[model samples]
Target: MKRFITGQHVSLWRLTKRVTAQNPMMKYLIKKIPPYPTPVEFWVSNVAHVTDETGFKGILKSEQFRAPKSELSWWDLKIKKEEIRAAEKNYMKRNFSNKAKEPNEQKPFLETFTTSPLFQLKKSRYGNYRFTFPLAELMEWYKEQNCGGKEPVLRVYGTVTYKQQIVYTVLIHSPEDSERFGEYPLLEASEWVRYQDGKIIWKAQAICETHRYQFVSGEVQRLKTHLFYVWDQVSLVFHLPNRTKPCKAVKIPRQRLIEALEACKLDRKIDLLRYKSPKNKEERFFEAKMKVSELKRELEEEVKEEKSEAENDIKMEVDP
Candidate 1:
């Protein structure tokens, strides 16, 4: 994920350099050009062809801001106006169109947007993942969660599922919020979290399916922006598990979504692998307890390794 920038923006030159560095042929081709690459040409030839999530495929990587106003490219101004027009058209369509508008063939221009959990993960033609969530519902949830009286701010965490399903899970609470949440796991994301539009956007570097293990490839924050939900096709999960036969997703009510959000908090304590039903309450509870114990042991061992007198870092190259 670090291959992508942690924040919305990063240097186009450096981003391209990383991929090209890995693929020597691309690097050599790029190096053939002097001083720096022609942004549009490089994007069209190589970046455009990269149909993966890690690459800056749907990103606003074209326009860059620099010292002088003259240094900034016209791309940003033109694209911004186009984006505003797209939004205006969408709003008009929603209000006036008789039928539900068809999904845009072009991916979203997400220069100003952030992560949202209300989306549905769907398989793409290229065996990748693309998702869509309602903007209106998300905004409502955000207000309900953050603006209401004495409501504890919801905390979100990202983790890879046991099957290596790369997903951002809303695990109960943050450590600082223990007074309200009770003592649990750190409840912290791998990196910082940015709460936006009711979703907690995490800048995490995990062992995802696509980008492999990004432990410490580089040491730049601006360049290390592997954000979730910022692009169209996300290839993070190698195997999206089949818990049951797939069914058409029903459009859930926004009110249900708000209720669902509340139920996932530390107060309700759901989806911690500890969720119980009417029939298997005791069995599931015990299973969750055992799993927690096992994870505690793993954590202990990790702490021990960290406390050792002096040890060299052992890097593992476990890629998908």
Candidate 2:
């Protein structure tokens, strides 16, 4: 009879345990526990590409600024207008000379114009666009403004042509340096193409309004003059037809470019590795708790199961 009672008790306990384990509440509790995070998943969650989310937009927005006109009494709008006229006059002269030249003579003039300080000609088989600026004259203007205590203003006045059609006038200026900063019109460009072969081949062109920016003081502030200096030297070398090797266009001096990058807070460590999510210490702690809580719940459930099994065995023996 005792052996029979032990067998019945064992069968009843097994049935009860199966029913309890299959209960909706038990299943819900089990699902409430999250799975352990793998090391690869954790690492991936922390780092991201520079182009992710607002990455590109954020960088661009940081570089943009529009100062009020009241703040720029120093920059006379008339000067910018005059610079445009000067560039226009030079363009007219070059157009006439270019039309009169034969194919052989044209190459010399084209090469000379590409390096001219008073003018810049970007030519390809597609078409040619000219950008003209008198750096010496602009420097004199800068001195007259007594911008020594202030940042230098850059004004780009040029034109673009495509398929033998005159596209539009290209004008851009540093926003803070303009009289009407928030309201002024300027050309907006994408990445500044690194100068190649003493020429710029335009990938595309558009009629848009935007501004160019520069730092108040640093290598970036003086970058314009430095690039122009290099351009002047390269242009002079190419002017000679008897030149042995082709003059490669260098955008900026190596040392100066390095110094400029170091001086820029954005360009220095921007491309380096950086954390992506959990942007703060508090969030990191929360993630740790999440992982720990999952492990803790699992351990507690395992202990509870072992205790239940042991107690069931003891009760079955005691009942018999």
Candidate 3:
């Protein structure tokens, strides 16, 4: 009888365990606990109890805490649904708010322009000149052509102006070769303009002789008048009327005139060139002319000095 009674007690304990496992409330409680040890289950149970007593289904689903479905009444479930909707709306609002700022953000213009296909084409078409012969070959050819056997050192000074504004200036030096016939360094100048479509495009190109030539070994003869123009398969000469012959002066483009003005400023002192007699027009003109004459004289002196210095440098290099 004692053994039977012990068996019955054990059976009763097993039945109770099974019933608890099946109970919805117990299962919900277990579900509320995270895989890791956390306070989420305790908080959910407290919220569920409060919501049940207050008859507020919405309170259970509030951002403060979320109750298990088995513990929440029908009304509390409705509140949870509303909370989910509100959270979704808030997320959407945040996402859209971030997107709105992008249009106003500054972007890199140069990087985009350089990557564009049109820009690439423009660069390829005008950026470099194709020469048939190499410099060494050109030098040999010059020797064979009886071109004075003087090695020519060409110095090219380039200035680019756009819309009456000086944009760029560069000095390129190339030593002439006599080996290759008709071989010269390719010269290319390109100007970029931005379009309404946010695309950067090339506007115009002005090419000129790069002043690089091959001469035979002998006296270095400077070309009498260096040619300046836009050359590509054809040459367009830029004519500057003699400043001394004002009446015969060709209309100077505004861009060229501006460059000339800038050059003049750098050529001489500004204060000495300014007119002091503002009250008398004739006197101002006369004074201005005299100032110009003085500036000219100074320029000539400076040129002479430069020439002398260059000669001295060459002498030193040769002597040393």
Candidate 4:
């Protein structure tokens, strides 16, 4: 016999099925989506929170719905185990590849000294300067001098250059060594005694004159003077080193030219955006006008609200 089911009947069937799906026995029988493939992304992303294969296995084994080990075939267990191992390997590779690439053994300090620079003082074309000195050197020097125990660190004398201005700086290096290095040299002390107390408290031996080199600058300052003094003793003098040699002119390299071109292109793009065509300029002006108009409207609304609030207060007072 031919029997046709109405739409109402079909709806009722679906409703009944949905209601029965809530039943504990039906829950297991209802075909569930096969467990989603364990995402490779899960191993790498939010690494601090993700569980390892052992932890995951423990979770699966603890689940109430999981089948018993005995129920599963040996091949299934082997496959799952292999999958877990593969996942672990992927996790290890992702996390440890960089670590593996890192140098495990460091070369000796003396070996490194020949290869690496102890200090670097770089001056750029724009008059910016950068200086790098090893902190370990100062500590090592202090240790060698025995500044910590018995012996003190006296006045520290070091040459410091600021923007190509070389100054023979004498500072109280350490309280321990202060008395030793602070003592003025015999010649300077005699000169200081001859001069008035306030007239010359500190005598600085100037090897280079201020007004000597008016036109030359930077490393070229070396050309202005041929005489070099060490502790008031003439160490180098008399002979001119490069009297006939011409000064080298600064040339922009090809790479610098390419970089400049790129910079020019970017500046041109910005200029075009700001003032390319009358239409774009007009559009910008229109946007600015709209913003101003909006601000004016907001201010007017605020004023009206304030007036209304005052009126309301007055009305309330009158009613009272």
Off by over 4 Å in 1: 1-121, 124-152, 156-163, 166-168, 172-180, 184-192, 197-199, 204-320
Give the clashing pairs for model 2: 186-210
lDDT of each: 0.26, 0.25, 0.24, 0.25
* C-alpha-based local distance difference test score of model 3: 0.24
Among all windows of 10 consecutive residues in model 1, the one with the lowest summed lDDT is 41-50
The better-scoring model by TM-score among 1 and 4 is 1
Please give each candidate's TM-score. 0.23, 0.17, 0.17, 0.15
Best by TM-score: 1
**In model 2, which regions exceed 4 Å deviation?**
1-137, 146-149, 155-179, 183-320
Which scores greater on lDDT, model 1 or model 2? Answer: 1
Residue 161 Cα positional deviation in candidate 1, in Å, after optimal superposition: 4.2
C-alpha lDDT of residue 14 in model 1: 37
lDDT of 4 by residue, 1-320 (tens): 11222111111113225434434423322332221111221111000001222322332344211112222100000012233334434433554454322222311111111110111111111111111112232223333333442322222133322221222222213344345445523223232111122111222222121122211111112133332211110000001112223311112232222221100011211121322333443353445345434545665677799999999999999995
lDDT of 1 by residue, 128-151 (tens): 211223323432432343234233
Native-structure RMSD, model 3 = 42.7
Candidate 4 global TM-score? 0.15
Instruction: Report the error of model 3 at residue 265, Å.
Output: 20
